[model samples]
Target: MKARAVARVLGKHVVMIVLMMFWLSVLVFCLSRMAPGDPLQSFYGDAVQSMSTGELEAARHRLGLDAPLWVQYEKWLSGVAQGDFGMSLKYKRPALEVAGPLIGNTLILGGAAYALVFALAIGMALICVRYEDSWIDRTLCAAGTVAFYTPAFWLGTMLVLVFSVNLHWLPGSGAYRPGMAGDVADRMRHLVLPLVVMVASHVWYYACMIRNRLLDEVRRDYVLLARSKGLGRRRVLMRHCLRNVLPGIVSLMAISVPHVLSGTYVAETVFNYPGIGLLSVSSAKYHDYNMLMLMVMLAGFLVIVSSILAQAVNEIIDSRMKGAERGGV
Candidate 1:
């Protein structure tokens, strides 16, 4: 029975992933192809006029710009099937090679930032639920709203100013020192500011979510009955109340996964971090179409995968709880 539940969830995720990939591919193809000026011509600049007609044709052929859109797309799809995104027209290297490291960096930063956020947010939410609208709860909620609306870039700047520029407590920017003795320490230092910026901007969002869920759960019949049974608040909250709250948490987590993936572009680019967002901007400026396509597609894929994972978790949890109740043993 457990195996069947797992299989069902996995099947749904697979279907969703396929749909997401298709949508992403279509978007990538249309947007770049529709952009003003031919990419081949854009790559050559004014020198296009200076080139002999034969030279121009050679350049077009070399880049497969001469192929019809359908044909080009077909070729691209074939390469994609083989796990090749093709070579970058501008970077002059395999598109995947350039994007792989940067994607890893962005994921690392985003994962760490969100992990801290989930922990802090849940902790704060529990506190607020325990306190239930005291000065501290109201104050933090007020401050959190202000922080949530502030642009990530501005918040990041202030953090750098306070922690790095003024106090000299943290490095202002960059991933790590080139000749750092150990990668682990250097990475931890690099993560500090960006993660702080991420936490500052978004922690409130999750805190509010978890807080609202907590408040609602405590008011429900199960919780009230649990309280009547003389169970401590912590026990009710930790064991019983949270069982209901967690699905919402998982759903929200999944919903934000895409946002988390996309948001990295904003935070990383703002801080000059070595992530796909920064590299993506560079690729766009260079008309590195191949790299840009890969980046966009990859971001989309991650989002789809996140949603799928969320759905699976939901199904599994629901199935298990229902099963337990049915057994009544």
Candidate 2:
């Protein structure tokens, strides 16, 4: 019975993700088609000015731009099914090959930022929860508010001014110093400002969510019972309330994936980091529909996968809690 229930949940999430991907592809395809400027023209650059109408028509046909929007999307989607997202119009190479390195760069930058955000958020939450209703809690809450409201770009710019320009402490931009790309220390130094900005951009939301959820759990009957049974405050929080709050923290972590991706857009651009976000900026400037559409699809895929994982975490935690209750009874 439990196996059947698990299968049903997995089946539902798979169907939902498939439908979401389909609609997301359709929406992004239509929007890219409607956007201004021809990618071929962007690709050809000054040469576009000299191309004859027939030449332009041939180029359009070769690039599938001459087809009806639906036909174009159909061709693209078919390619995607075969692990090809079409070729980059600008680079004249497979989109996957061109985007491969950028994806890895994004993973590194986003992964680091994600780790820092969770660490700071959980640490702040624990501190605030321990000192609930005190001045420390109020101070942390205010700081969270500030971080939540501050634009990532502005914060990154200010950090650049202070640390890179004024203090000469870190490289102003790029993934690494031009000649020092092979140096681990140099690469890390270059990453610090952007990583800090990305973490700051997201820490507040998670911290607040965690703190609020934990506080709510503290007021629950289970927590009260634990405390009344002679458990110390810390013990009650750790043994009772904290476990109950894990699912909420997991949910917040899953939901924050997109926000972190968006923050990467700002952080990468501000720091001139050569990641998916920086690629996205350039793709937009060139109206590279193939690259842009692939990015949109990737984002949708991440959100769907994260959501499913979050649900799984919730189920696991809830089952454990139920098992604990049964054992206690």
Candidate 3:
């Protein structure tokens, strides 16, 4: 029975992933091809203008751009099924070759930002809940609202100005010092500003969501009973309220991961961080269709994976909630 349940869950997620990939690939391919300006021209530069008609046709054929849109998409889709994303017109390299190094860089920067955001958002939300409409809660809510509305680029620029230029405390941009791969301190110094900017820009939204949810959960009968049973304020909030609130938090965090990864374009560009977000911007500028499509597919994959994980977590938490309701705790 357990095996059957697991299989059923896997099958559901697999179907969702496959259908999502199909539609995403079709939309991405069509939109990329529809964009103005010839990728061949961008790839070849001034030489493209000087080429004979026959030479241009040959170049197009070689790049598979001469094929009909449907045919081109089918061929690309086939390659994608086998984990191939074709070649980068700009770099004359495989898509993976161009994207592989940048993935790790993004994961490092994004992962750190995500961890800080998750931890601090929860902590801040709890504080707000504890204070419960006091001055501190009002102040935090206002600040979080400001942070949410503030453009990431503006925030990043302000950090650079104050910390790097005025205070001389942190590096303004780049991942690390030149030729300092093993210098942990220097690398951390470079990371501090961008990391803070990413965290500050994102934390408030999640914190606010958590605060509202905690407020609602605290009024539930279970929580009231826990307080009546001689549980202290912190105990009731942390043990009874937080436990029930955690699944929602997990779902929210998981859903935000893909968005955070995708949204890093502004932050990464501002910091000159060598991450996939920066790579995507460059690829878009150079009309590197293959690279751009690969990035899209990758982002989709992350969303699908996170969704599956979140569903599993939700199921587990639901079961626990049911058990608690049945006095089986």
Highest lDDT, which number? 3
The whole-model C-alpha lDDT of candidate 3 against the native structure comes to 0.86
The superposed Cα distance between candidate 3 and the true structure at residue 80, in angstroms, equals 2.8
Candidate 1 residues 182-273, lDDT tens each?
58788888888888778878889889989998999899998888889899888888887777788778778777887666667778877788
TM-scores of the candidates in the order shown: 0.87, 0.88, 0.90
Candidate 2 lDDT over residue span 67-149, tens digit each: 99889988998899999998887777887888887787788889899989998998898889888989999999998899888
Q: Sort by lDDT, best first: what order?
A: 3, 2, 1
RMSD of 2: 2.7
Minimum summed lDDT over a 10-residue window in model 3 is located at 258-267
- Candidate achieving higher lDDT, 1 or 2: 2
lDDT of 1 at 257: 81
In TM-score terms, candidate 1 sits at: 0.87
* Residue runs of model 2 more than 4 Å from their true location after superposition: 1-12, 179-182, 220-232, 317-329
Question: What tens-digit string does per-residue lDDT give for candidate 3 at 93-195?
Answer: 8999999977877887888889999899999999999888899999999988888888888989999899889999888988777788578788778778888
TM-score, predicted candidate 3 vs. hidden true structure: 0.90
